[model samples]
Structures are given as C-alpha cells and as structure tokens.
Target: MTVNARSGLPKDRPAAPAPPPPPGWRRWLVPVGVLITLVLLFLPGMGRGPAQVDYGDLAQQVAAKQVDTLRLTADGTITGTYASSFDGGEDFVSHYPTGLQGVDDTFLSQVRDPSVVPHFQATGATGSWLGTLLALLPFLLFLGFFLYIGRAARKGMAGGLGGIPGVGRSKAKVIDAVRPDTTFADVAGYEGVKRDVTEVVDFLRHAEKYAAAGAVAPRGVLMAGPPGTGKTLLARAVAGEAEVPFFSMTGSGFVEMFVGVGAARVRDLFAEARKRAPAIIFIDEIDAIGQRRGSGMASNDEREQTLNQLLAEMDGFDPATGIVVMAATNRPETLDAALLRPGRFDRQVTVPLPTQPERRAILAVHAAGKHLAADVDLDTAARATPGFSGADLANLMNEAAIVAVRDDRTQLTAADLSQARDRIILGQRQGANFLLESEKRNVAVHESGHALVAALSPAADPVDRVTILPSGMALGVTEQMPEEERHLYSEEQMLASLAVRLGGRGAELVVFGEGSTGASNDLASATGLATRMVREFGLSPALGPVGYSSDSPQYLGGEQVTSRAYSEETQRVIDTEVARLVREAETTAVELLRSHRPALEALTRQLLEHETVTGAVVHAIAAGSTADGATRAPVSA
Candidate 1:
C-alpha cells in the first residue's frame, strides 16, 4: 500500500497563526530609500554660516569703542559680540584682509585711551579651516552613525547584523504560487520515483477523501540518489502537482558557526511551514546536517542540534496538519537513523540511473529546444550513454549545441553528438603530436591490436573506433561499443574483456619484442579487472567462491574505504590468482594477434594511412575485405 493508504490523519483544521513575513522588493526599498535620504542630508551643504559685516564697519565700531570683545583668526576673519545696549548683539561675524595690522594697531591705540576704551582683548583665532571642521565634527559623526544604522536595517538581520537572535530566524525560501513552474512532464525519467511521490501529492491534494476513508497521509518522503538524478526536480514536481505552498531550503542553510543557531533555524523553518498548511517542505542535501550523529572525531554541536531539531519537528507535526517534509541527499548512507524512522521520513525513494527507454525519454526532453539534424537518432544516443544521470543528459544536450555552434553548423548532427560524447568521456582529443615515423607506427600498431582483439574475441564488446591522435592522457585510444547495458556479466565475458584491455601490450611484445610505457594504462586497467574478478566477483577457482573485498558506498566520490576481509594467507592467494588471470588474458591476446598477424598488419597500415580508423574499417580488415560492409563504403579518418 502507498503512504496515502497508510495515513489516518484528519483533514479538517482551524486557520493557522500568521507566518513570519517574507522579504520582498517593498521590504527592501523602504530602508534602502531611508539610507539614501540620510546620505543626501549628511553630504556637505553649500554657503557659509551666520551673518556677515564689512571689515570697514567692524573697524568703525572699534573706533567708536562699541565692541565689547574681539577675536582674530589665522585666515584674517574677525568676530566680536556687541555689548547689551549695542546693535547686532552677540551674533555678529566679519572678515578682513590679513594685511589689516594697521587697523588693528589703530584700534589698540584708541583702546589705550581710557575714556574711549572698549572692553576688547585679542582672543583666539576664529573661522580657521581646522576650527570650522572641528565645529562640525559632532554632526558628521552623527550622520555617519545613522548611515551605518540605515545600511544595517536595509540588509536585515540575516546579514549578520541581528546577532544571535537574527541568526536563529528561518532561511527558507517560500513559494506560494497556485502551482510550481516545473511539473512532472518537465522531468524526464524515474517513473518509480515519480509514482512514489505522486501518492504523496495525491494525498495532499485530496486529504479529505483519505481522511474520510480513515487513512492518514505520509508525513515525510526522503529522496536518495546520486547527484544530478532529479531529486530536487522531483520535489518541485510534487509541489506543482499538489498546488500547495512550498518551502525550500538547503541543509547547509540551517547550520551556523554558533551553537544552537542551526537548531533555531530548524524550529523557525517548521513553524513557518506550519503556518502554510498543506505545504511541502523540501530540504536539499540533508546529509550535510543529518550525518550519522557522533561520526566525527570532535563533536559538531551545531549540526547535532540542527538534526535534533529536525527530528523533533518531524515527530511533533500532526499528519492531519497537511505538512509533508521531503528531503534529498546524495549521501543517504551517512544520514542518521532517527531522521529516517517510520513517522519521520517514512519512505526513502531511490532514483537510480536511467534505463535505456528512460534515457531515450530524457534525451528527448532535453533535445526539445535544439534543432537536430535528420541523421541525429536519439535512440542511438541513449544506447551510447549507459550510466548517465538526468543532469548528465541535459549537459550532453547543451554540449551538443555548443559543438554545433563551434563548428558553425545550423543544426546539431549525429557527428556533433558523437564528438560531445567523446569530449565528456575522454577529455578533448589533441592534434597529432610531433612524433617520429617509428613512434607513429608503434601507436597505430597498439591501437590496431586493441581493435583486432575486441573484434575477434567471442564475448568482448565491438570496437567502435581506433585513433592514434593524442587525447587527454592517452597517446592512442580504441573505443568500444556495447550493444546493450549489462548488469550481470558471465565469467567468459569478464575474461574476454580483460584480454581486450591487455591486447595493446600483447601486440607491443609481439612486434617490438618488448613493451613500452605506452601500455601503463592498459596494464593498470587489466590488473584492476583481474583483481576484482578474483577478490570481489569470486571468479577464481583458487580463491573458491570467497569475497575478500568489502563494498563501498555506491555514489561517486562517496567514502571509498575498503578493508580486506581475508587473512594474509588468503591475500597472498588472491594476489597470485589476479596475476595468473592477467597473464592468461595476455597470453590469449598474443595468440589471437599471432593467428591473425596479416589482418593485424593490414589494420595497422589502415590506421597509419588515415590517422583515424572507424570500427567498420577494422572489421573489414579482420574479414579480409577492402570495403567496409557495415558502412557500405571505405570508411575515412
């Protein structure tokens, strides 16, 4: 039964409390405008301060003994406050030339006469630049202080301004549209995943029906898959289908350097999600915080608190409230068990790599915007990519478009797709290196050997192309084409595959009477395959159905710690068996090359002439024909 069938929660509930306000353009504009106004008001204004009086008027007043006190500035400006009975009392200011020493002396002489003397003393300088600046310093300080405050207000507390309290607030991005933009139709594959999520969406959309039937909706669904497998996209599609509020946040968004901060965010996120009932809360990359508790050497109090808060929220929420928590993580193996318990993330859906038909659907979806040439067959492209995720397929389509644009082509052709695939698989192919004729011949012979062995071996994949041109780290490459995906390989196929890998060195040994460093990659690959066959696949008779290697997490870049499960004696036997397998494969490759020595020579000559030889060309040479039967013509470089 689906999660909807299991849920017995009621649908009827009262209105929720008001949610914390979402940030918007209006919220930002108010504080930003205030800051801008403060900036305008605080900028230095035009014109001088106070009233002005001529230097002559000030001297006449001094001559009449009307001034009570006087002050002179370094810039030759004067100020004096008039007596109580005098005009312009206490607020008068005046400017005079710096060369007015004669006037000042005359005034002093007049003042010496007791009867005409005014209470005037040469006080400290007034109206100096430094003095004026010092006078306005307090106002400037106020303006700067306010400007900083305004900026802080505009950015909100999340900019680390609000201290511990602000950091505790939720960081979820709420989407309250009638429907999300990305529907299930937009997603390409993972039908099983879609079905699992569809049941949740149906329960959300029709909760009353399920409630009437005494069913309660699932509280949570966890999506576990490798990166780029559309986990997040599927969550969006679920939201779109349910037509409810969607609150999205990454697991890392809840974490902070401070203790209890992540927990606060977790509480805040759930509180807001509850405010919008029938909502989908999606936490992407949840393993960031939900990692198995106590796994680290030192304690991660912040992450642990966040995980605990999440667990509590999931447990505390009523299924009747119509809040379903959905989370995605590439490293599901690292998540805490509490987070995946029955009432929490009740269902864990695995979105695996697309199968053949699923891949075709993915290709078709990604190809919608591109103009494809008639020769571009999506089915063929799908068959070529065995382990590509949905994101990889999208990237492939984009790379194909880029290839088309680079080549100045109007539409994407089969050749563009092929080149894009090669670029993704092996790094970009390099131009011919400036090697000697002998070196070139050696590379051609090596590649030809690989193609020859692959074609002649009973269970080996067919050779797709052989090239002597440098590509990435390889000086030569022989691409193989599997007709279909193979999950379970027989012992015969594994041995044949191992022999094909060793064919380059076998040919080098037969032709040059010694192997060069050119076979380093080939030997490494053959050794790895042989080791797996003996230790992991239990293919060695000597090892006798024993698996000496432990399995690691499946996701790429996941923890790859593999401990040997066997004792030292078994390890020695394993090493011996792996070496024996490699030797036998090499021997088989050498025998095949020797038996078809003439064909091998002919294929090597073709590669030398063309610089690149198609698989059709290799097959023709192996079949003693000059024309490529597969292509109905002589294939070129």
Candidate 2:
C-alpha cells in the first residue's frame, strides 16, 4: 500500500475522515492559541483606563427606581434622571451629579418601600464554552487515531508492536517473484567466489544438464565472508543470472523473540520454496538460526530443533525437483555442520573486498549519473581506498554527490570526494574534541611517523592521508592507499607492512624515550597479522608450509571443530616468531627516527597546524608503503 507522507494516510484507502470533526479536544487548541495570544495581546494593557465607564451604578439605580427619564452623560457617566412616583413629575430641584452612590442609602422610609443606589463593575471573560471545546479538538483526534492503530495491531491487520501468534509462520518472502535489480555486473572481484556461484547459476538456468547427464548439481551454496564484503548482494547476482524463481529472506527474521515459532517458520519457508520448483532460496545471515547446539542460548534446544528441520529439507534434495538454497552469514563458525555437509550446502563462496580496479569499476558504476569535476581522478580515488568494499565505495559516491548537492555545486570535485571519503571512513571531524597542546603534539608525531614509515617501505604504498582531527572512534588516523590493486602478497611485503604498523609506537618511544598507549589499534593489527602469518601462512619454523586445520569454509562451515590448530610446542614457537617480528620492526623504526629526527619533527609540526597531510606530502619525506588487506529481498508488487 502506498502512503501519503503529508497526510500520514494510505494513498489507496482515501479515508473520508469527516473533516476529523475538530476532535472533542481539538476545539480546545484554537481557543487555547487564541486565549494564549489574547492573554499575551491584552494583558499588557491591563493598567490602561478607557474613557468608557467601568461603573454602571446609575443604570442599576434607575432600574431599581423604575426611572424611564434617566439620562446618560456623553462621558458615559450618569448625569441626569428623575422618575420618582412620590415626586409625581414635580421634578425635585435638588442637584449633585447623579451617581448611584450620591443617593441616600435609606431614602424610602417604610410605607411602600423602595431601594436606592447600587455598585457595579464591568467583568471581562473570554473563551466561551464552545471555543474551549474547539481548542482541545486536535488532542482528542490524535488519541482516537492511536487507539485505532493499537486495536488494528492487536487484531493482526498490521502486526502490532508485537506480532500476532501466527506471524512467524508467515515470514518467508518469495524472492523469484521479488526479482531484484542486482546482476553479475553489480558485483566485482572475488573471481573465485564467482566461479563457485557459477555452477549453481548454471544448474538453475539449465536444469536439464544434470538430469540428462545423470549427475546432480549442487542444491545450495553458502556465502561466507566478513562484514561489508557483499555476501547478500552476491546472492542477488546469482538470482539475476539464473532463469528461475528466487526467494530471499534473512535467517534472523525467521527466529523471533517468541518461542516455538522459529522451528515452525523454518519448516514453512522450505515447504513454500519447494512448491516453487526451480526456485532459489537465499537466507541472509543464516547463522541466526544456524548456530551450533549447546551454546547456552535459552532456546538452544528449540533452535537446534529448527536447525534439524532445515537440514532435513535441504538434504532431501531431488535435482529432478529443481529447488535450491543459498545462504549468507559472517559467523559461519557458529552454524551446525550438518547443515553445510556436501549433500546439503555443497559449496561455500567467499565474497571479499574489492581490488583497486574493482573499486574503480564500482565507483564508476555508482557515479554514472552524477556530474563529475575535472579534478576527480578515478585512479586516485580508488588508490586512496585500500580496504573499502563495494558497498563502501558505492556509499562514498553517494556521500560525495550529497556533499556536492549541499554545497550547491554543479559537479563533485576531488576534494569533495576526499572529504566524503573521510566522512564515511572516520566519521565527521567534530570540533568538540578539544585537545591540550602536549596531547596534540604527541598525536601528530605518532601519526606522522606512521605515514613516513609506510611511505619509506618498498612493500608499502604512499600515504593517502594523515589527519590529527578526531573522528567517531579515533583521536587521529593515517590512511595509506595502494599504488595499484594487489591480491597475492610476497612474504617480504607482508613483513614490511607489519613493520609500519609498529612505526607509530616506535616513534613515540624513540623521540620521548618512552611510549604512550596511542599505539593500541596498531599493536592489535600487527599482532593479529603476525599471528595469522604463523598459524595460517606457515611462517613459523615450528609449523611450515601447511595449514594444520581445514579452516576453509568448504569443509569447516557449520562444523564444531574444536581441536587446537597446533601443538603446545608449536604455539610457543609461533608466539616467539610474532614477538621477534614486532621487536625487529620497532628497532627498524627507531633507527629511522634517530637518523631523520629533524624531518620527523617537521612532519609532526605540520600535522598539528594542518590537521591533515596528503600522500604526496608523506612521500616527499619517505617514499614507500604496502600491505595489505544486497539483496532485495522481495517484491509485494
């Protein structure tokens, strides 16, 4: 249903709201606004005395005496009157200005008693009863509206603040009908991932290949990748590439906080998918319901039950039937191994971060309709982003265009793109993080050393940006963009890049003869990299040239393989090797600092003043660097 943003009403439903009849309380508001406005308008003149008489004692007195001949003064004060029955038109010649107070209090003695003068004051009151009712009209209208919505939610028309009991059973989205806009062109890099997905797409597109050949095509492919790597999008691309129905829904959506519903929903999803033969079921974030059993989740028993149902349906795949399943999740380790066995998932494809060329392609695709400034170099932009994924690049383009729009520019410039990049990567550089002079100096030196060391290393690339300004998660950041995109890295290059990760700490220690905690992130990054090199890359002498564990998702996904990757002796050797790398890199950075002390001071001073340093600026000092590192769901239409 289409909704009208202005009226907050359903476009198709055209409700005849009875002019909302100035809700009982809505009537109160206008009178309230008027009353408030009038109070504001009239209260200021409370002391002003008007020429009009506020006291009407004469009018009362005349009425009490039944004086028809009473006269009103031009000053609106009572001046003349005489209609005393006792006087019988004799006209009493007694005179003083005729105010009711001027008469004697006891004028009529007893025989046929009559009363004398009285006192009067004109009282002003505003906001009649009708006006007050109108004033509160709006409030009453809103109350009725919310009540209607609340009731509707409870009755299951629109899922209430809490869904109706049967809602969990109805959560699966029929995706082939959804037909997302993503195709293969929308995805880039990860050729290995594409190759793995290609087989599945081929099977969906040509069901006869396996049927005629007496071989079964894979029934499912589990997409396992780190966050921001476009796993969900890859699923959409597969759907776009295939000539079958696609059903997409998140794994988490199947498991509501409500109990017993997850298992029922899982069964329902597969049953529905099966009915749509030659269909693709893409469940993004499958780990939500696919976690290992006995994880102490309160619903572990039920969740595992849900997993069992899902595995059974996935397992009993009949190629002749033409139904397939694909799921995406970052935490693949948590899933049940039974769900990912060869007969079930059969394959795992890893969608990775885009290479430089791929990033440029992604940028171009996103920037297609936007006006570009002459200074916007696609190569430079791609190089400036080393770790950005396809989604990040797309977001960068969107942010740049937004900046251009905000600044009222006809085109997006390189500087605008760079600013947008920083905004996306580090968050806005807020002015609120005021730093002391000493702290500022220390941060500048630390970041500048990172820039210089990366630039000086042959394995590392030139520094793209170095900034001392604070962002969402950091006091400062130094970014290094690659010269070109790289996939495979040499052992030397990896080691060199690791050295630069230690450079900031090295500079702090060498310059001040001690170090601060500014190197926390860098230390963690270096440590993890060194550890991976040992455990996975076989860089440690204790474990050479072979991965001890089958960490590959093809075999490891959903499995509960708890054995250590290496023996205790091997772990000690691995730790020593990592420490040796860190210590050696520290020594190298210190030596460079001692030799280029003057230049180091200059760079840091410049950073303090500018708050940002460019790649060219860092290259001018040092010259090296390297290292490394969705899905429409458905359409109701």
> Of the candidates shown, which would achieve the greatest TM-score relative to the real structure?
1
The residue ranges of model 2 lying beyond 4 angstroms of the native Cα positions read: 1-168, 175-178, 189-205, 238-243, 256-260, 294-299, 317-320, 486-495, 505-514, 520-581, 622-637
Q: At residue 449, what lDDT does model 2 achieve?
A: 78
What are the Cα lDDT values of the candidates?
A: 0.80, 0.70
Error of 2 at 477 (Å): 3.3
Tens-place lDDT per residue, model 1, 1-637, is 2234224446546776775686677689889979976765555454454457787787787777777766665566666677666775565778766675456677557645545545545545545455576688899999977676566557554443344446669899887755578899998877778899998878777787777999877889999988888998998887676667788999999887756678878877877876666678999999989999977657788788889888888886443257888999998988998888898988889988888889999999999978999999999899888888998888899999999999897699998998888778777887665567898999988988899888887688877889887767778889887888888999989999998999998898888888888899899999989989988888989889877555453433455555555688988998899899999999999988888899888988888999888888887777677653543222111
lDDT of 2 by residue, 1-637 (tens): 1211122212333445452243488578777978876775566578733223223443344446633332232333332334555334332212224555654444222102334322222233344454775688799889967786587566554234234447557476675546778888877667788888878777666656556898786878888877888888788788777767677888777766545566667667766765565578888899988887766524465566667777877774323245678899888888877877898888877676777887887788888889998989998888888888877888899999888989988699998898898898788866845777888888898997787677666677667789898886778888877666777888888877887888898889878888888899988999888888877787767667865553443334465545575578877887888888778777777776666676688788879888887766666655222221111112111
The local distance difference test score of model 2 is 0.70
| Clashes per candidate, residues 3 or more apart or on different chains | 5, 29
* Per-model TM-score versus the true fold: 0.74, 0.61
What's every prediction's RMSD, in angstroms? 8.4, 15.6
